[model samples]
Target: MATFPLEPVHDTFRAIATTVVPEAVALDRAGWERLEEIIAEALASRPERIHRQLRLFVRIVDWRARWRHRERFVDLDPLQRTRELERIERSRWLLLRRGLWGLRTLIFMGYYAQPAIQREIGYRARPEGWDAVRGAGR
Candidate 1:
């Protein structure tokens, strides 16, 4: 199983929240502390399944960014990026299909909260387009 770093996830959330709610970010430290408390309380009420979905969401974004900039950063052949994106999409679909409320929450968050991230990172090619690559199971 793959895991994502928590700080980056949190930072991403903060960035999204700040963009969506500028007043929240404009607050002083004490105000931000209270906002954090509220957000924590809300998240605590959700099931653990949400965390799994969140992890997948973060991973997909990270992978998509890498894939989009593959030429600039590393020597990922077209085949390699295709295989990796397929793996990530499979994981995301599985979580979306089988996980519980947490998964649902994650989907909702992704739908609403992910536009900026997706805009920044760009989208992967559709799975079918990637199917021609070896190791990207149809």
Candidate 2:
């Protein structure tokens, strides 16, 4: 059985990811599964420092949820989760704010890297004029 990198915080991270990038919440089941695989792959490629930071971020989010609303981040209702995340995004502590930004960045990176999203955004691996430019030099 393969274990996920963020197993302990998977649900919390998924909620945060979908909340931060609302478009991701629109993904179908297959798309969501693909997103999970992409995130797991990215996490496996990173250094331990990044892995630790992500885990710590989940803990902080959970702690904040309990402190503010008496529930775990993953257990909160959608509105409450959104409110809590927004609060953290606006937190006075720079570290917490930055951490949330980092998490958002990772989520966005993985979400947008998918082929479907890439095409939707008109991102092509090779532009139409690339061959013309390359052949011109050749």
Candidate 3:
């Protein structure tokens, strides 16, 4: 029931999320499964063009990993995977780096903003105080 074309892409994204967020290690099996589901849901809701672009980007990363290390990105050990991604993060091609950056940002934001995570981190939502700073004339 994945909105994406290939389930492997979801696996790759899960691997990437795990690599980027060490906190993910603390998640139980069900938590990890739910996290992957959350990421897939996020990708499914993007515009068509963006969805395709992100998919293509994952394919490219997979290819790059195999070409460089004779293994898929998800197959690489944690250290190797981190090193490879770091290389991509420093790419001269702005698009490649930016795409990964955007994906990483989305993954981290989604994971950390979960209500359970918020409570675990003691992140209490506060009422907006902007009214206090409104113009006196208003």
Candidate 4:
């Protein structure tokens, strides 16, 4: 069976997303499904190694949290999850830290790219910098 965010690490991945974006905690079931679709789309074009790394890193987070908090990351209190993620973000291994950063970037991209979120944030395209878009089909 597949996990919602991505399997074999979706529990931790979802926990991480909610920690990174507290607003996500309030998302409805359908909203979470949509966000997962968006996140999957972002990963679909990546190299296989990227996919493997993400799975590995997410699992590592779960294991580390278990060691530190005596519970699955998904089961930890929100503050504990956030602090654990912060510790990983400050890891001495550069690659490890960058992986978390990449994960965070992905979450932001998936969360903010939703049409409702874009509208809520008052995002709109401005074509003034390059006239090509303004004149297209004109």
Candidate 3 lDDT, 1-138, residue by residue in tens:
344333548778777887889787688877765565666677776677887787788888888999999999989999988998899999999998998897788678758867788899897664655554464338
What pairs collide in candidate 1? 50-102
Candidate 1's displacement at residue 35, Å, is 2.1
**Taking the tens digit of each residue's C-alpha lDDT, what string does model 2 give over 36-83?**
677778777678788888889888998989898888887888889889
- What is the Cα-based lDDT of residue 62 in candidate 1? 46
All candidates: TM-score? 0.38, 0.76, 0.77, 0.84
lDDT of 1 by residue, 1-138 (tens): 122223346644444334334334455655444444444445666666755566566455445546676542123444544444445446656653343234334333433333343454475445567565554654
Off by over 4 Å in 2: 1-3, 121-138
Best by TM-score: 4
Which pairs, if any, clash in model 4?
none
lDDT of 3 at 28: 82
- Give stretches of model 1 more than 4 Å off: 1-8, 62-138
Q: Write down the TM-score for model 2.
A: 0.76
**Candidate 4: stretches off by over 4 Å:** 1-5, 126-138
Query: Residue 102 error for model 2, in Å?
Result: 0.9
